[model samples]
Target chain A: MESNRTESRENRYLNPYLGGVLLGLVVIAAFYTSGRGPGATGALKGLIVTGVEAVVPEAAASSGFVAEYREPLPGHPLRSWLVFQMMGLITGGFLSGAFAGRLKFRIEHNYRITSERRLLMALGGGILFGFGSQLGRGCTSGAALSGMSVLSLGGFITMVSIFGTAFALAWFFRKNWI
Target chain B: MGPLVIYEVISENINLLTAFIIGTAFGWVLESSGFSSSRKLAGVFYGYDMVVLKVFFTAAVTGMLGLLFMSLFGWIDLSLVYVNPTFLTSAIAGGVVMGAGFIMGGFCPGTSFSAAAIGKIDAMVFIVGLFIGIGLFGAGYSIWQELYLAADMGHLKISDSLGMSDGLFALLLILAASAIFYFAEMVERKFASHRL
Candidate 1:
């Protein structure tokens, strides 16, 4: 019972509105220097290309993930800026969670399902999302959120597709979340 | 004279440093925004909370307007800013797949990291699954290669396609976002109490 109370309070995070403003500032900073925005999938892209290169160098070079990712001259794909940025995301998030004393390891789910079922959905869902991120050129953060901010048409379209489909599919997945 | 690397304002090596700072801020804001929680994120879909919508639209609009102003101020050249490359068919297909992933996994790449920071087991699993997802894509690039490379639209921005001025296009987006913000607020009031 005590644990349940803590869990519910933990669900309450920072104000969403303030979060938006800060997020916008971050996008602004991203654009000012790199002339682009933050992306979620590129790190994964780098890993994919690097993984394949490790396994089959020639084929990996020919693949889109590698071809698009190859550094111009002497640079390596694994030495990517996005990968580092992703690292920072993990670090920053951890630091903030630490400060808030909200760190814990547990599966979050509705009362309706067993933790095992929820984990299963998470794995299956992750596979599909990963596949989609590659196909879509980005996941929600990189393609949808950052892209839309810059008024990229593809960004707008992908944003709609991601959220739209989630709404459509959410009902089937409802037990896991709600 | 800017976009330093492109216009010779900065060296190639140093630009990577900028990418690091940008990422730090990006991660910081995402965590602070309540995006780190899957329950809150899913709330937007359920109409119990609109933080996702509110924050998403606000940030998008803010960035959009900032881009316009920067261009106006000549602080940055609009032409130099990267417009995400378009491969329409695959982009949509990828999005649809990711959407299902969103509802199921309960976190996207960026947000998953945020949740993990807070020690959520589900988020960690989701991320482990994300690596597999990307790895699988790399290993099986053969299957989706055609669709991925097909509809070559060559980095087009919607404003250019619509024949609208950049400022005008941005204004329209702002108006649309504002409308959504209003409605989202109402939806939150009606549904938020039911949320965890």
Candidate 2:
């Protein structure tokens, strides 16, 4: 009975509404302090750009994408605020998982699928997301949430397209998640 | 006077530190809400779990209201806050692509980070793919530059576009959100027995 109770407690998560409130406050804090909302892809983009610059300085310097990113920087590309924020995200996530007893190195997948298949899907999904986010100028955090908060039209459009497409395609991918 | 770092009320270094602190709080809340589980995250699409919809809308509304109130109280300069620019073609196209990614991957960029933090190996693979995807995008920027920059409507507000007051639009959103929450609950119940 004791072990069962402990297991239940370990699996429990915070109430959804409460989590939303906390997340909102975090966004507000971000805006008030930095004049911008939270962003995840930008940080990743920064890392990618930094890697390219390190590996091929001439190529990176000549590229329009890399040039745009590097033009505004006075220091190393990796020394961006978004990069720091992403590091914080990692640290915070680890701490939370550790505290919640949820930190375990494992692959999560549908019962019917193998771990290898799941990883492949994940890789394919990530590639699509990364490419799309670059074109979209933001991901869920930067575009959808922050944009919606400010009542941006583009934000609304992006949100609709994203969720709508997902719903439309969810049926096809049902085997993966369901 | 708001956006302290932008106004130079705080040093750049301190602002960066704040980013880290805020990110920590963001990650903690996301993970605490079970976003670390891709299955749970995907449940929003399957209707077995509505946590994502509930949390996302609630947070957006809360932040919107908070920003409005703060600006009214003269505690912050809402005008200074960045609003994402609207590029019609790119937004829709990109979002469609992202949607496909979300269902297949069962996570978004932010949620994936939190999920990976909890030691999800799939999330790790997703991150590696993200790096490569981005690298490819940069390399091929020339081919899609036109579409990416097309139909630019600079920082347009939905409320303004609709001729509604910001406060009024926000109010309507909250009301709509409540209705959606009710519907979400019903859907969850219907699917609960089936185990989607």
lDDT of each: 0.80, 0.89
**Candidate 1: pairs in clash:** B48-B191
Report lDDT (Cα) of residue B42, candidate 2.
90
Error of 1 at B15 (Å): 2.8
Estimate candidate 2's alpha-carbon lDDT, on a 0 to 1 scale: 0.89
Q: Give the alpha carbon lDDT tens digit for every residue of A1-178 in model 2.
A: 9988877866799999999999999889988998888888989988888888889989887898987777767588878778888888888899999998888899999898899999999999999999888888888998999888878898889899889998999999998887
**What's model 1's overall lDDT?**
0.80
- Candidate 2 residue-wise lDDT, B48-86, digit = tens: 889999899889999889888988999888888899999
TM-score for the A-chain in each candidate structure: 0.89, 0.94
Clashing residue pairs in candidate 2 (N, C-alpha, C atoms within 3 angstroms)? none
Q: Please compute DockQ, using alpha carbons, for every candidate against the native two-chain complex.
A: 0.69, 0.85
